[model samples]
Target chain A: MPKIKYIEENGKEHVVEVPVGWSVMEGAVKNLIPGIDADCGGACACATCHVYVDPAWNAKMPPMGDMEETMLDFAQDREATSRLSCQLKVTEAMDGLVVRMPKSQH
Target chain B: MSEQIVIIGAGQAAVQAVTTLKAEGFAGSIIMVGDEAYPPYQRPPLSKAYLLGKLERERLFLKADSFYPEAHCQMLLGVSARAIDRKAMTVLLSDGSRKPYDKLLIATGTRVRQIQVPGAELPGVHYLRSIADVDRLSPEIVAGKKLAVVGGGYIGLEVAAVAQKRGLEVTVFEALDRLMARAVSPQLSAFYEQAHRAEGVQFCFKTGVEAFEGHGKVERLRAGGKLYPADLVLVGIGAIPNVELAKEAGLTCQDGIVVDRFCTSVSDPAIFAAGDCTRHHGHNGEEIRLECVQNAIDQAKHAALAMLGKPTPYREVPWFWSDQYDLKLQIAGLSRPGDQLVVRGDPATRKFAVFHLREGKVACVEAVNAAPEYIVGRKLIADGTPIAAARLADTAIPMKNIV
Candidate 1:
């Protein structure tokens, strides 16, 4: 299991151990982490699951696909490191990855 | 004294009511009655991820299992609201009990419209509606099997996409001339038809399924004046609003439970309805019923506020999306007849948008793999912004800059 940290806009942090195949959005949703709406339920159709990734862990993950890139344009506080958490699948090498949630996601 | 709010049908709107009431600091008793065994869950993935076995049962839930109890709301799962005693402000349940409520919300949603044909009751024929429906259909969705899907709507096409990806031989039959004819524009329907064709999904347009023929179970279907062999038959024609309960309770029902802009029953102030079960007079003064998650969630929120005595008219721009074989279609606004259409991007690349204009103002937008257009198009529709046809067609002008 890869341990991932999710920080909310108010600075509240939740650290959960996610299975290798599950996405970060799934982990946060399963752990009942607030502010990560995942409104479209991880279909990447809705941008409610927007997350700002820590630059250090961003490189370790796969680059944003065209679909995810197009979806981020809907996020209220989109940043360069912003990604749809649903598209980011967890792997063994991604242990201790950190991402911040936007207030808009709530 | 805390007011008790009773919500019938624990689907998307029902669950949304529970959360909204609690978040808005409504110190009231919340009672949710659902006919399903589980709490409110997301149904979109049932045909996509859950059917493909990528999603688990627990994840289908809109909220974690414990959230309901932790929120101090009472849930009556595997039960239903049989009758509404408006005078007594109580609901008769299928379990021979009554639940009293100060306010009531009817979010019964819609039910799958089954194909009324011979051999419809066969074993291998399936209709995807509830979680249980998909559960029963999962084992049959295997590779090297033949699937004959009836109806070329979003649900039918989605099942075809999943089946195609699973290496199953898939064929779709649509009575209309094109796919998603009622929901999308002709350009998109043609685009999806081609996309699915490239994925080896066969399509029979302007055809209808007359009957299903097989031994004891479904083994073939008769459609388009020909009989096609099938291991399993899936029907996704569309859905009819669940309004019998409301209609029997003496509320006005037209197509759906007739409600005002506030989601309140036109005949009763104490009663409210939302989701696919509602037909409200929209901002445009037209009675409309939308079957989408966004409408369900937003309308439920509006109903909660109305119950709080802070009534806000439900006038949010309508939006919907569909996923099929790596193609995602996002639609916004309602397209009316006589609206002029403008194509924004090249359909050849499969990343484009079609905008509907009424009286020189943006009316509706259908975007395929175009996120910027959908995001901005929604805002434009909401604002009723006017745009020049040339500017909308010019992909060089960033979407955000158009408004």
Candidate 2:
């Protein structure tokens, strides 16, 4: 299990252990953490699950796909570190990962 | 007396209704009755990821199994409401029990439209509506299998895409002139046809299925004076709203159970309807029945608010999306008649958007692999903002600056 930290727009923090092969958005949603709506239900079709990854943990993740990249263009306050949480699958190496939810998704 | 809300149907809208009620400080008891054995799960993945085996069964759930209990809600799974006694303010269940409610919500959703042609009862024939439907069809989606898909709508095309990707010989039959004729523009239909064709998915347009020819199971589909040998047949003509329950209860039913902007039944304020089972009047005065997750979620939100006495009108900008191979088709707003179609970006690259403008305002936008347009288009539709056609057509202009 990968321990993931999710920080919401309202300064709430949720630290939970996510099973492998589950997306970051799923980890948040399954744990009942608010702010990551995942409206398309992890299809990466909607950008509602936008999150900002801590730069230190960015390198451990896989490169963004075209669909995820295109969807990130719609996220509010997008940054180089902005990623759709639904596209980021959890792995053992991603332990201690921290993702900040965008205010727009809140 | 503090009231309990009894919701019929345990789909997306029903779950949202309960969640909204709890989130809005409603301490009343919430009872959800669903015919399906599983808790509320997302339906979009049934034809795509779930069928392809990329997603697991448990992942499809909108919330964990413990969610209902944690929310202080009671769920009557695998049991359906047999009757609604409006005067008695109670629901008769399939298990021969009655549940009383001060308020009622009908969110029974829609059922898959079955093909009435001969041999439709074959074993290999399937309809992609519920988890059980896909569970039966998933085992048949193997490599090199012949798949004959009936109907070219979203479900049909989506299943075709998944089958094609799984190395299956896929052929789609459409009664319409083009694919997705009722929902998308012709340009999109043409684009999808070309894309699917490139993926080796054959299409037979202007063709209607006469019957399914096989022995004890579907082996061939007879359509348009031709026999297509198929190992599996997936029917996706469309869905019919589950309005019979409402109608039986003497509620006003048209295309769906008629509801107002607040999602309250036009005939009875104490009874409300939401999601696919509702024919509601939008802020623009159009009576439309939408069958999308967005509508299900938002309409439930409004219905919960109204039930709590907040009474906010359900005026959400309609948006929809589809996933075919690498292309993501996103649509926002509703296209009205005589809308000027503006092309932004070239479709040759498969990253373009079609902006439908009515009365010089952005009425609707269909974006293929263009997410910015969809995001901006949804906001533009919601705000009713006008934009210059030339500016909208120019790809260089940032979508955020259009308004």
Measured by DockQ, the strongest candidate is 2
Best by TM-score: 2
Pairs in clash, predicted candidate 1: none
| RMSD in order of candidates | 1.9, 1.6
Which pairs clash inside model 2? Answer: none
| B35-132: candidate 2 lDDT, tens digit per residue | 99999999998988898899999999998877788777899999999999999999999999999999999999999888999999998999999999
Span of ten consecutive residues with least summed lDDT in model 2 chain B: B64-73
TM-score of each: 0.95, 0.97
lDDT of candidate 1 over B264-329, digit per residue (tens): 999999999999999987656678998999889989999999999989999887788888877788
DockQ of structure 1? 0.60
Worst 10 residues of 1 chain B by lDDT: B63-72
Off by over 4 Å in 1: A1-3, A16-19, A92-95
